[model samples]
Target: MAAIVWQTPANPPEPEDYIFFKGKRYVRPYYFEFISHVKNRWAGKTIVDLFTEEFRGRPYEYYESAVKSGRIQVDDKIVSVSYIVRSTQKISHFVHRHEPPVLAGNVSILHSEPDVITVCKPASIPVHPCGQYRKNTIVGILQAEHGVAPLFPIHRLDRLVSGLLIFARNAGKAEQFRQQVTRPYCYYKSDDVI
Candidate 1:
């Protein structure tokens, strides 16, 4: 039998990106630039109106304020709230992102192979970025901690569920694994059993 050697993740998480408070882990608020190109339907629409219709995440007043304060830009230049958008024009919206806290449990690596990496996912952490989470997710943590980027998960576990997760190191491996394992198996805690 070949001996299994354990190796540490190549990349470590940045200290400034996280905060620990009262036994919970939170991603520090940071400025994020959201970039997008004007769509055909958005052409001729005022910047404020376009934001209000497409991005309901923030209220109309917030978008208007952002435009006035230069937090929103068109083609890297500040524009008035009433500026009409044109097709192919680049838009950038800089906003401070705040992510909710999750449990302090760790994501433990179980196995690492040439084309696959497996980990024991902790509860309260999502498989990927969704909703109110970005850097606090399993994929984000692995990328920051293990230097693993562009990982493809074979299956996903809910944010509140804790279980083993398999990740493909590359896109080709991910596709191969998906074809081989037609029905991925998941282990749930007894409390979740019906």
Candidate 2:
């Protein structure tokens, strides 16, 4: 596990806000994370249009600046407004959380029992083993940090989306959680509170 830490402003930021970190200490506020959040969530807009709308302080100058500065790269190349922003696509200027296979502090223990562990996973963390996020996911944190190895997540969450995630402490209970999760309302059927 690599040594990872976060630094933030004197005032805490709401979830979805961005802050720059220097080791375990916060350096300063970087930029507004709400730009991506707003652009990504809106419907029926072209990528360029979304970009222009989100970064409201400038005109063509801003887009030109982002392109010229090499701050925005897509598909390993500097992208123009023509690039389509699809689901799960990595945006330029996006701060990717790429902590190595270690216990990321992003997870919160929502519920824990002998059978399972439920967590309120932040938007930036991965849910399970995939891509560069395998061991930095919710299951990894539960097993490695919380002293529960062999943990399995009941469902998967997108890397940049916030939601509840469940991990199985044992195989049997894992399957039960799996069954309930697939049934939609089964989360309510079995756990009541989730």
Query: What are the per-residue Cα lDDT tens digits for candidate 2 across 97-174?
Result: 443433224567888887877888876667765544434556555554565566776778787788887778788887
What lDDT, from 0 to 1, does candidate 2 have?
Answer: 0.55
lDDT of 2 at 142: 55
Candidate lDDT values, in order: 0.85, 0.55
Q: In model 1, where is the ten-residue run with the lowest total lDDT? A: 4-13
Alpha-carbon error at 45 in model 1, in Å? 2.1
Over 4 Å off in model 2, which ranges? 1-105, 183-194
TM-score of each: 0.80, 0.41
